[model samples]
Target: MNGYRFDKLKLLVADDNQHMRKLISTIMKAFGTTSVYEAESGEAAWQSLKKIGIDIVIVDWQMAGMTGLDFVRKIRNAPDSPNPFLPVIMLTGYTHIDHVRLARDAGANEFLAKPVTVKALMAKITSVIENPRPFVRTKTYFGPCRRRRNDMSYKGPERRAAPDAIDVDGIRPVGSGKTGSHGP
Candidate 1:
């Protein structure tokens, strides 16, 4: 494990459950985080974000007013957002493949299932601190690059190589207007 100065980092924990918030705060404190903020809902989280200079955010998926996914989307796409480049770690009990994909698509930097352990939490924190992903800006998405790593060994056809690559306007690229001889 790398030696990180967690005490110097300002983290925000957003969850509706009081117990969950305390638990996460306790765990983060144990990890040496001195400045940890807690929010009871997404709206509160947003307010805190606007007021505090937080380094990282750990939010629950289901909140009272706004869900974690919605919060992430707003953070990534909202023009008035304080820090669009802020790193967010989503915590939820929904561990299904679809749920994971949904969180990723919603612009979460990392995902952690509920009933989290210290080890898992620390690993995610370290990963975010050490190997942060590059941000990608598109018409519909503005967050960390969705692709985690390149799989060179795969033999599947390249998705972006086709003329249907999504451009800034949601249509195909300009030069890709001509259809292939195969079909329209």
Candidate 2:
């Protein structure tokens, strides 16, 4: 709260549960976010996103129709998506690592486990604003860069030459007249 302010942000809370929506809305309001909107289903949330100008989105994973995962996929992969780069904070009770990975793969900018707290929620928001992740776009993926930090300790197969090209380490160049792998 020192250098960051939420007063001017327009945030959306999308959840099927009424109490959860209210609680999140209350928390955002407390954080000085005046323009907070709520949607009961992912469909409604998608509509809101297409209609209004949303700064950030906090979406629940589970919903009646068009689950949060689907919504995120649409935002990231859909041709007519309103905003592909819009910041999204995935809200879910599933704290499992697999769930986290799933959310990340789906293009969420951040993740917030359920039973949300002021500190944790604010931390997510601030991180998104203060330190935005570079967007990644490839043939199979489009979203925030999954890597959080650089690791020089170990080596792994490099997948792409640039963010837009898939240059795998063990793949033959097309039309090179070579029909074999490059490396192990």
Sequence-dependent TM-score of model 2: 0.81
Q: Write candidate 2's Cα lDDT for 33-109 as tens digits.
A: 99999999999999999999999999999997799999999999989899999999999998765566577778888
Clashes of each: 0, 0
Model 2 spans with C-alpha error above 4 angstroms: 150-184
lDDT of 2: 0.78
The TM-score between candidate 1 and the true structure equals: 0.81
The C-alpha lDDT values of all candidates are 0.78, 0.78
CA-RMSD of model 2:
9.2
